[model samples]
Target chain A: MGDLTPEVQRIAGNLLSQGQVDLVLGWAKAPSNGQSVPACIRQAEQAGRLIFDQYCIHNLATGLLDHRDSSERIGIFVKGCDSRGIVRLAEDGQFPRERLYIVGICCPGMKDQAACDRAASGLFGETAGDSELAGKCRQCAHPNPVIYDELLGDQQPPFLNDVRFSDVQRIEAMGIGERGEFFSQIFSKCIRCYACRNICVACNCRQCIFDETRPQWVGRSTSAADNMMYHAFRAMHVAGRCVECGECERVCPAGLPLMLLNRKLIKDIDQLFGPYEAGLSLEEGARPPLSSYRVEDPDPFVR
Target chain B: MKSFAKSAITVVLDRLAEQTRTYVPMRDGVTSNFSPWSERRASDLALNSLNTTFSPKGIVFPQTERLYDFAVDGQRADISGTHAETGENILFGARACDRKAFAALDQVFLRRGYVDTNYKARRDGLTVIGRDCLQPGPFCFCDSMGVDPMGADGADVLLHETTEEFGWEPLTEKGQALTLRLNDLLTEKELIRPESAGCRLEVNVAGLPEKLRGMFDSPVWDELSTFCMNCGVCTYICPVCHCFDIQVMNNGSSGCRFRCWDSCMYPEYNLMAGGHNPREGKRDRFRNRFLHKLEFFQERYGSFGCSGCGRCLVTCPHSLNMVLVINRLGEVKVDAS
Candidate 1:
């Protein structure tokens, strides 16, 4: 991919200049030094402010939820993984596919610059090299978007060496007892911050079930069992549908291996279901497997 | 139906290995659970053991599954993608209650608004080998839910244990194929039916929809709510609870997003961003839980949401059983016209 700044500017300017889209959504530097965040550029003049690099990690789909009923067509920039969120929203029938223009970039996996800084120092190390990107980026195969109306750079081949579940393999190598202990220790660190949930695009719910007071399923206490239930149940809810974008783990302040839990589900989904992707297509009327039922489905419980 | 002695069942497991991944109950250290068959060892299998510590739902609705991934700089999102390793596996030694529980889950996760292809693929590719429950645990209550312990309603291959012989009945084409593949170890024998295990808990959920509607304001919920610490163990261990939340994470310019499970018991479950909780207290929360399972599910899916597996009885720190609560609710005499 070309320098992210120029590529973002060129794409945004073209979409705006040609009147193909009413607005261009990209990333611009946050007020903090070199920290980039999602931004909406309504005019060609603002395109120069756009920046794309390791700092542009937010799944901008959350921002689009407000625009679902709008009549104007909008152009949005996205990395390969971020496109899955849009695909999911489209699949859910949350938005009209034709109203949006996609400026897909061939991403070369961005880093969790914050985490690298934290590792370098007790708080968040400031001296860590830019090369010390997030683990998700290091293992990313399709850093480039699978679906895009306009491409910003040369299409790179998918990474063949990426092993999706290497972390899961490490955890599975331990004996059952050891594995339990390891998970319990990691789970104990969860303070129920819901940061992982807040940062997840797939977790978009009008009212999260965890917050439902009627049944009182999970308690307010941050005990071991409660924490375990919170994390485990949350992971199960998104099984088979998770795109493995690794945003949940990145926003986690406690640095829990939240991605491992998601990857484990992805692994199981692949193991049980045929190879499936979250959102690489615009085909309407296609259904997800978990939502449909067959009367003859194999039931192991009946005897 | 063909009958064989208990000893002959081991030969069936051995023969099953020739074709597919055969799973049987085995002792892993001190605990006994169903796992993939290792060597051809009869002692490794634990056929009559208690329900596995983890529910068999993982075989269908796995924990920590991916819904999909997408990236968005702003208004546009793209979702077309595929993951590696979607294959097939077999689950052996699933119990009757767990089987019935899947039937209920199938209604929620599969039969609901959006068809989850991930779940459907696993449901399609997997074969369930069920064993009849001769003994019911203290917490077992399948009979109360109108499920027959010995009935082969859900099993692909149903196994019946008898003193003189073990009977294998194929309820579906997949089961028939599996039986045919293992036909080498079988000898044609007469069918011998076993007696049914009587229902352990008696629950009249027939009028529960009306009964619960009138009983919503009843003080009975307050009594049940007192014991609940809101631990969420019951929902986690439950095979049918399917509520969830979606979120997005960003660090600078690039980030991934996801969805995870959520429970109704938490205070934050219904709390909006402005610190407003719709179901404010334990009483309201308690009522909504039962209403969703009994009334809402019936209203939407035409059946009670719960399958009566009784995992909540075993896992609850307070011993608040749903059966006992429902029974008490049933006893609340409301005036009829």
Candidate 2:
């Protein structure tokens, strides 16, 4: 990737100085431990803190949710995966497109900061050698931003040039009982921390079902049944709307393969509702397949 | 001192497993945490790891626990349930930082005239074996938090790891009994203890709690909580975060009251019955979390709530963590008026 730090700094500084944006959401090197982290700057003078690096893995688009209630205009830096999240939020009516000044980057597959920490700690038996492209970046179908007010860096090739549903296919090949056991094993480790839900830009529900108390939808217990319910519900809920950013899987402390469930739904949705990828377009009245309906849509369950 | 060769760790674990439910830090797939000892988990034993991804607090204060069961009958209520009970168990190979967190937990559950029966039951039956940190991890700051990396005050048995052997020093009756149980495996050898290294990370937490008492309305909180996504990652994975929420699982007329781990980061945690939430915003929740850790916990329990185990550092999806929060707090210029 090109050194877009100067460009990012200049854009953020200009946006803040010109009173175009109330906040500039970007990445900064954490002072305590040199790791790149999502940072926000209100003053143009603080624009020097903005950076773009391989370790800048967090999707800043999720940060937009924090300001949805306010009328504050935000200037945000977005990688390819993160840009989809902006579209996801905008399409869901969580954040208006007018409130955002999206600065898009043609992402050159970033590295996972959490994975690096885990590897350095040697707690997971992972050596430094195992560090590579973040799981989300590896599956990137859109390295170039699908929508942007201003684009930066050279356009890059998608990391996943081959079959996008290869991992999903492996799970589909499993016998019914095997598949059940496979998910059960993953769900068993879940502590129900909801990092996946919280980190996700697509999970922009004003009030999540899990957090509902009047008629508590999902059990708070971290039992296999409850965890399975949570994961399955979330997967189906974001079926067509998922940006395939892999933030859900990346943030899961239990190391659950959440993308498998997501990709499975993506594949099924594609098969059921063909050739559809979510958050790719900002066309007026565009909506996810599940969110919008037609008379000719698949009636597999109806029959 | 009773000593055991590094190669005989499985043998030692097997012996302990026969007598009690032993939880050893072991690698599980891509993460490591305390789990029950078994042949399958034996090969994955990770005693040398800085600290497990998940804390062993669940061993005593479980993530979700059944409080009681209730049934509604015509004009009558039937509440019949057993209090939590447990047999003797061993927490083997826990680090000093994690072991220290038990004290904070004990203060919450077993003090001030309101002893939790479930917590008491588990606390009474659990024996801790804390391992010394000869080499502290980059994120570890237990010393700055007033904990000795080499000294685990609350551990029954303290294990000192050297080049090829472990020096076991029993501090309590439980530790002595455990030492006696594994006498055949442990040889009476004097192993040279390695020099302890300090954590690369350090913060001056001196008078921090006292200082934080007057900074409730400070603008620093607004700046500090800016990028915090308000996720439960920090609280859930934290060794010392001990808040919980109670709920009921209803099936027809019968239900069981269960309490699960709750994060103050959630808005509903402080939501009022009258549809008024005192901590409704992310900033309010974030401020409360750090204040609770830095001020309220210290004022109430006479010790910092955080153990500086650094689980939050490694696990927080966003880079918001205790170290950053504390450092930011340190930089705040307070007013005396």
Give the TM-score (vs. native) of candidate 1.
0.51
lDDT of 2 by residue, B1-337 (tens): 7889888888898899987999998888888889999987677888777788889999998998999899999888899976586678899988888888999999989998899888899999999998888888877888999899999699999998998998899999999999889888888987788879888889889889889988999999988888777778888888899899988888978989988999899877888888899998889999999999899999998999998888888788887889999998998889988
lDDT of 1 at B160: 80
Tens digits of per-residue lDDT for model 1, B1-337: 6545676666676667656666676654323345667564556566656565446675566544445555666777665463312565667767777788778778876887887677777788778888777766555667877677777877998888676666777788888888787776666777656676655556778788866767667777775564344435556557677666654433334434444556777666677877777887756776788788888887888767776666565333334557766777777788663
> Which consecutive 10 residues in model 1 chain A have the weakest lDDT in total?
A118-127
For the predicted complex of model 1, DockQ is 0.02
Query: Model 2: runs farther than 4 Å from truth?
Result: A125-131, B72-77
Candidate 1 regions with alpha-carbon error over 4 angstroms:
A1-303, B3-5, B8-35, B39-45, B69-80, B83-86, B247-259, B273-275, B335-337
The candidate maximizing TM-score is 2
Question: Please, what are the lDDT tens digits per residue for candidate 1 over residues A38-152?
Answer: 6777799888889887667666765566466678888988888878777777776776778889888777667655554333322211223567655566666667786678777
